[model samples]
Target: MSEAGVSLEMSKGSAPLTPVLSANWGDPRAWKLVNYERRGGYQGLRTALAMSPDEVISLVKDAGLRGRGGAGFPAGLKWSFIPKDNPNPTYLVVNCDESEPGTCKDMPLLMASPHTLVEGAIIASYAVHAKMAFLYVRGEVLHIIRRLQQAVAEAYAAGYLGTDILGSGYDLDIMVHAGAGAYICGEETALLDSLEGRRGQPRLRPPFPAVAGLYASPTVVNNAETISSVPAIVAHGKDWFQAMGTEKSAGFTLYSLSGHVARPGQYEAPLGITLHQLLDISGGMRAGHRLKFFTPGGSSTPMFSAAEIDVPLDYESVAGAGSIPGHQGPAVLRRDHLGGAHRDPLDRVLQARVLRQVHPLPGGHLVAGPDAAQDRGRRGGARRRRQDARRQRPDRRQILLHPGRRRRRMHPRRGEELPGRVRGRLPRRPGMAAAALRAQHGLRPRGLPRRGRGLLR
Candidate 1:
């Protein structure tokens, strides 16, 4: 191979911190192409390049890698749905518009090891016979978009992308798109609408993206984490990926844990990992507080209690426990004593990862919690005026805060952020947990189109 073909200098990367998805996160040069190649990165794409697309798809199906996105569908099965005989060109659209309340994995993956995603995208596009792939990122995350763009440039420069890649006679191009800051766009159909420069909204289904998507052509849409896993699966072979996790849900995955814990961060382990194991490994509840309520995925997922701590965190187990393992992460909160936590000014603590507004009648059985909207008439006119003034901004911090026992030991102080921090939660090494304020959606299939006609991918 010519020196200009690929530049893998003497750069080195650290072994993953006992993490499957984040093995190269700690490496200072992990974002660079040379560093990526040094750690056996793009080799997956090369491996895929050697196999027929069908074989590649079968390998993933055999590995049993479920989607990291909330829906938990089989990744390979989703890919296999794209029609090979279609007359129009097929496309690969990556859902990177990560705006979930308690989720934060893809952004950090892009930041720490962007080339992993770029290589994975190339391989996925090739497997589906797609000549083009598009990554849809949220407009607010400009830095993440830049990082990914740089990775694509590096891949093209290394001859790992574009026409005649690595003398394999394959061609592919990747485009990075930024969407307007809308949480709803995290939905696949809305994301597709936004991608087409139309208003972002959900579409009907039946003709899912795999059949008729983006530009009315067959498309395969997957989130960043799902596609990022493809490289490892393609490189390591089916058994290597399946060796760790259970039979139904094979391979290691990214899990984000937050709230009042001794340590809270991203934990990448096999599918059936239990929260008891996570809490035991980390320092357990913050300041040694006992667990109270926790959301296994996000607010959208039903919350579980302390009694179910030992439940294995897999699709099957979580479902049996009355909650969907929509995503494998959990946001844990400790019981709070309302009186002391908030003083005269009404100090509040946000214990859960995502706290959506819930209003209750004056004396109803399901009254809102401390973090919920409080009684406005409690204070005199002046105090109410001050409260109204503060409410003007009503930023996330103010809204997230809830009256609780005077501060215990919270990792991230209230009002310290604008909702983001999965990177903080990622344990670069084993036996560590990260406390983070916020982090990080789901994709839907087309059963029918609603707004105009069909659903988005």
Candidate 2:
């Protein structure tokens, strides 16, 4: 095993913080190729170059490395999906378009150590037999783009890239592409379309990227952190990588901590670490404030309240806790941050955007039931009777605002119980919930081509 040059910090029996991708971030001039190589950087690529591509793919497969991107798909399995018999050239595309709100990990990683991704892309491309790879970054991030370009240039100069890399017969070329700052290109298929100079919108699936991708050839698209993780896995071996995270979601990853916290930045740790633990280690919330709500992944993931601080920040655990673990990291918001009278107008706008981006509503099961309509009518009738009784008493009741009380109400005609956090937050009218259900069921048809035949060219 090669030296990792990373140090793990632990406090007695508390949760430990393991830094791999971010290990050298604090080092002086860490982005330079010379500085990166001095710290056991491209040793993974060296080790990978010695093995057959299949063996390399199998190594990563056994390591249990999941994608750091929002979906958390298995990384090695994605690589193996490329068809061996296909005559078309294979390609590897790294998604550096960190356009999602609160997704801060990739841009910082590129700025701090662009070579990590460069080396990883080369290794991944080799594994999938891709001769070309593209780093599609958001065009608005000019500094990140320049840094990646410099890193690619340095890799070529050092013979870690280009033809006949490091005395091995394998050859690869990495191109840094700057996308026109479209948020939708963060989606893999849409990113591919944008890479080909088309409108950035999601392409239909089934013939997924592995089957038909960039230029209609086979491609393996991975997030920046997902690809950057490859180098350490190659150098350190499967067992070493698997030893850090849980059995299913193995390996260390960078978590971007921001919003209403004392220390907000990137904290690399094993999967399954809790938000409570993260907040504790990061100096907790801002002074005199308490955690109100947070997005476990980003605004794209469902909101988890302060009650869910202990939820494990892993793929399965976070999903189990009603949120998604992703590279967007946890954006913590305290009570005062949202409820203060002096809150900035920009903050209000951001809150609205966050609400809009949260993962789509829970399925129709929340409102659909055999006797749902009947049960809702009965409840509404009982409430009306009680109101009539109160009105006849001639007693005036003082209405007081209770912050702890449920502020919103559900539709009167719906009976099924919703999740605790979502219980009374919907509209109280009779048909709103049903309308939402209709909209949910209509989503599929909306996504289908309007021609009513098949996918349009």
Candidate 3:
């Protein structure tokens, strides 16, 4: 009736919650460096410079700042994980890939206050004893990328990002790398692989990025929101940070609102803020519409019914309600669309745009007929030849021996390995199947060749 029900605990809190990082989101030119400087944006970098790197790490640890990324790992704890004696250069990678559906906070944050992120990067790099930092952004957001590049240039121009910042002898260089968009890359290991110029895919973790990451060096990979929150934690002491939010989940976060809500935007509040409180700030569901199920954090997080609205939006509490906060926020739906009866207007428009670009194939699969397959093969073969020719340059003889030896080794295994290798190499080729390769190798269909029996010895 009254937007939604506010939690009794939130209503009972006597102290006012402070929203530091997101305090200026509503202001015009909120993203500009001039506006940010006027509001004491880079002040944290100044404070961070004066303190010892260990001291900065201690303050963050004392602040109880957990990761704003999906994992919620302690930010300070993550920094401390890097070995102090290690000679390898430590790195701080800010994950700016806001590809998670309904997660729009980082992009707007960058578009508005790229310096805040840059300043935060400088501070974070200092805390982790990193001399170099990289902000890996989503590739498709070219405008934001340009804005960030400009912001980095400004920081370098001001001597805030380069050597001996504020005469503290702490040097940091920031690089903005645009990712070829992939959802899996948001995962820390996958993000590292993408940063390394490879196709984005999740890597097994154990030797998590804290130990071996980014050129096989100790690295700290944090979400954009997580690193952006560092400046505020440094400016305001750790206790000031710990004072807000719950015990395990300390500090404020930006909650993005979209879909059927009367108002849709970012709301900066403490971690435990409930959906009801958010709805109150966002102007509730659209007019006469009622609440249906909602995703707690984008499509990856599990959905919650209207009855679970009071669950606190912290990592622990929301997880207790059968969802994780992650980087995204809840998508409120007015009715169930399980039967494909309805779709979001944005989704429909996107679908139409995609459909316009490519002809729909039977059963929604892209079809490649003989002609198309032949064209693809020719193009692929031509590209391979060009690459091989480049590698065959006379001046490149130093690396040629390595390639030759690899080819020779692989060739020796071709008889017994041809089936497996052919299947792996030409998985999509129509006529050049693994069975054909096996037959060409003179190997039996299900057993080894007569000569292979003696070779096995």
Candidate 4:
């Protein structure tokens, strides 16, 4: 994180470390509406009903809330963009199509606390004068969709979604719709298209989704996390919500942490938290390992090394770190898999994408070394065939026999350690197992030459 974005904020304010969105996620009955109501769930809707629509939007703005979906647009500010005078019906679309790889917060959230999202959708629709709202979930997670559907039904049964909710004279309805499982539909215009029973494709902007969306009407499309954040901001005052994070990026957010961490689960924390802090509490890396390089936000963001772990994870700080604040949370890669990460066909392909800055290739772009990049399983098959026949392809057999060589061939970027006397250690914290051998065997020069700006690949 840049000094400008977080240093002052850290030194100035006191914040809570407890998880907010995920607090009830561990409860067995969290998915039930009765249990949710018991935990003070529809209160935000009641509070919004008591106040005016404009007041709800204002509260969100004061909370300093931003979108959790790849784009970090402020939720309240985006809500305010809806024109009040339009004759067409205003709509609120809760975009649950979280198709970005490694972005898994919303699905688990719905499975655990589906009512949170349903209530949030209602409050957001009321704020924007949207009588009709839709929870556009991705088609792949059918179970999540079913949970959300049951929650919506519960809301109606409890007088939260149907006519004259809570006797507030504000009638609203929420529908749970599923998309055809296309990642591109996560885009607002494309989502609108898919929601309207059309082909999912990005629409050129001039009339953004706020002005025109589902069924060619005025609409507000927000991320599941972004809309789910609304209920909390409404239930608690803006000041209470603002008390947690940095001045510009306030409140707690659900962070999905996976890959080589002691505790790999959802962590809700104040924005601008450093990975070092997360690692400290997470038991650092799985014993005998430490973070080497990790994608700050999925594969699209820049890969950060151990030296940059102190960078704060807020929007401004991450932007300052020369990477966009990705919607998906961090995917920590440990030094234990250095050479292993590289040889793994998938890891190498993703690394190639991260390594190329200009004219980035599309999702299916191929990397170099076509022959060497042949699937490791295929090479193993060739080795087996060779053993049965003339017993040739000794190099292939060596790779199959040696775990390090096999990992280097399969998972190259994560290719780090292999079992040796020292458990395949290198000179440094995240040193290369192969490099350690080259150095130990005296193959390296007195001063190892720097190559490709410190890139092992």
- lDDT, candidate 2, equals 0.72
Candidate 3 lDDT by residue in tens digits, 50-91:
898899999999898988877788999999999887778999
Q: Please, what is the whole-model Cα lDDT of each candidate in the order they appear?
A: 0.68, 0.72, 0.70, 0.69
Comparing 3 and 4 on TM-score, the stronger one: 3
What's the lDDT for residue 275 in model 2?
74
TM-score of each predicted structure versus truth: 0.72, 0.74, 0.74, 0.73
Clashing pairs in 2: none
lDDT of 4 by residue, 107-218 (tens): 8888899999998999999999999999999999999988998999988998998999899889998999988756557767767877877656444344577877776678
| Model 2 lowest lDDT segment of ten | 397-406
TM-score for model 1?
0.72
Instruction: Name the candidate that leads on TM-score.
Output: 2
* Stretches > 4 Å off in candidate 2: 1-15, 336-457
Model 1 C-alpha lDDT per residue in residues 117-160, reported as the tens digit of each score = 89889988988999999999888988888888899998889998
TM-score, prediction 3: 0.74
Better of 2 and 4 by lDDT: 2
Question: If the candidates were sorted by their TM-score against the true structure, best first, what order would they fall in?
Answer: 2, 3, 4, 1
